[model samples]
Target: MENKLIVSSSPHVRSNQDTSYIMKQVVIATFVTMVGMLLKAYIPALGDALGLFIPLIVVNCLILARAESFASKNTPIKSAVDGIGMGLGFTLALTALGVVREILGNGTLFGMGLFGASYQPALLFILPPGAFLSLGFLLAGFNKLKNKKA
Candidate 1:
């Protein structure tokens, strides 16, 4: 097997490394980022602010998707870069989503009250159902822009 020349499907170049090996490397590289998120989660000033969403980025679909789609076929450095971009993108999107949900559900932004105490929060936005609905809408909007750009 070591002497064999393995072929990959069209357009993508290949290496002898298996999927598991590439995935492991990608995961290891991204682990550094996951730790930073955990650290932020423990930090007082920011923990309660956005910590809840930080750690979850480790398993974010964006990162995993990039790892499987790009890392498995690319060089280590490129894979690492892809992972970094995906990681940052994932975190940023989540942060924005959290902000939107927080503002709409609690009438607050960055823990600071918005629209005053008189403002009533939309209780649904804070709930799981609303979260999924919000995510769906966001994805739809993103897809629209992406298709238009393409």
Candidate 2:
């Protein structure tokens, strides 16, 4: 007697959503996030610090990925909610990351010194390498917590 076995990759599912619809959902979500940010922090100094990067958040990878992967497959309301969540997640992560790095590299956060004078800042943390290191650590932490909850 002979037995047959099959091996295959994950199956694909189809959805009725289209690109234009997904783009609209992403726009809606981005607008909401922007409005919230504007209301919460109206300081021009923050604007100056973020500058062009603030506008570029619309095209951020996190937003686009959520659009193509989550928004495209879900209803408009659901897509918008997902987009908002993802956008806020990015915002908080970057903010926290910058704060941590600033404290380590400059001995200050938001213009307030955490360490007294003569405390040598970890100059390396402010550099590109430090960005990478901080991001990696943050992602690892998020992953660990997410997996634990699941």
Candidate 3:
């Protein structure tokens, strides 16, 4: 009788420290930078409206929070997709808030009047505190619906 031993040829350890992750990071960073530049160059009106806020996106806490928590734990591709989803979520939230404020405060949607000329727009809804009130109501509505479903 003879004794024999065999070993399989495969990686025994898994690691995140790899060229693929590094390249993905680089690609995502470059794409974000390019998008910023394009927004500034092509959307002059928006650039003017937002002014320095555009540049402030680099230091935006929403982005930083996701990067620090989600991106750090997830794979590179997943992190990138999550970043996009977060952005869309943010956009939808802001747009909803803006629409609510506009309709209540100005009686207009995208500058088109929805109410009769005799209707009075609520000035209080246009002020800074109005943002807080609108957001609170929106959140409350969402919570009510969520609880109902649950």
Residue 114 alpha-carbon offset, candidate 2, angstroms: 0.7
lDDT of 3 by residue, 1-150 (tens): 000111111133113334333334444455556666787899978767877665455436446555656778889999988888888888899899989999999999988999989879988789968988989988999999999999
Q: What TM-score fits each model? A: 0.54, 0.56, 0.60
The segments of candidate 2 whose C-alpha lies over 4 angstroms from its true place after superposition are 1-59, 143-150
Off by over 4 Å in 1: 1-62, 144-150
Q: Candidate 3: which stretches are off by over 4 Å?
A: 1-59
- The prediction achieving the highest lDDT against the true structure is 3
lDDT of 2 by residue, 10-119 (tens): 12211233543344445555675575478447876776776666656554644675567786578999988887888888789889899879988899988988889979
The candidates, ranked best first by TM-score, are 3, 2, 1
Residue 47 lDDT (model 1):
59
The predicted structure with the larger TM-score, 1 or 2, is 2
Instruction: Quantify all predictions' global Cα lDDT against the true fold.
Output: 0.68, 0.69, 0.70
Better of 1 and 2 by lDDT: 2
**Model 2 pairs in collision:** none
Q: How does candidate 1 score on lDDT?
A: 0.68
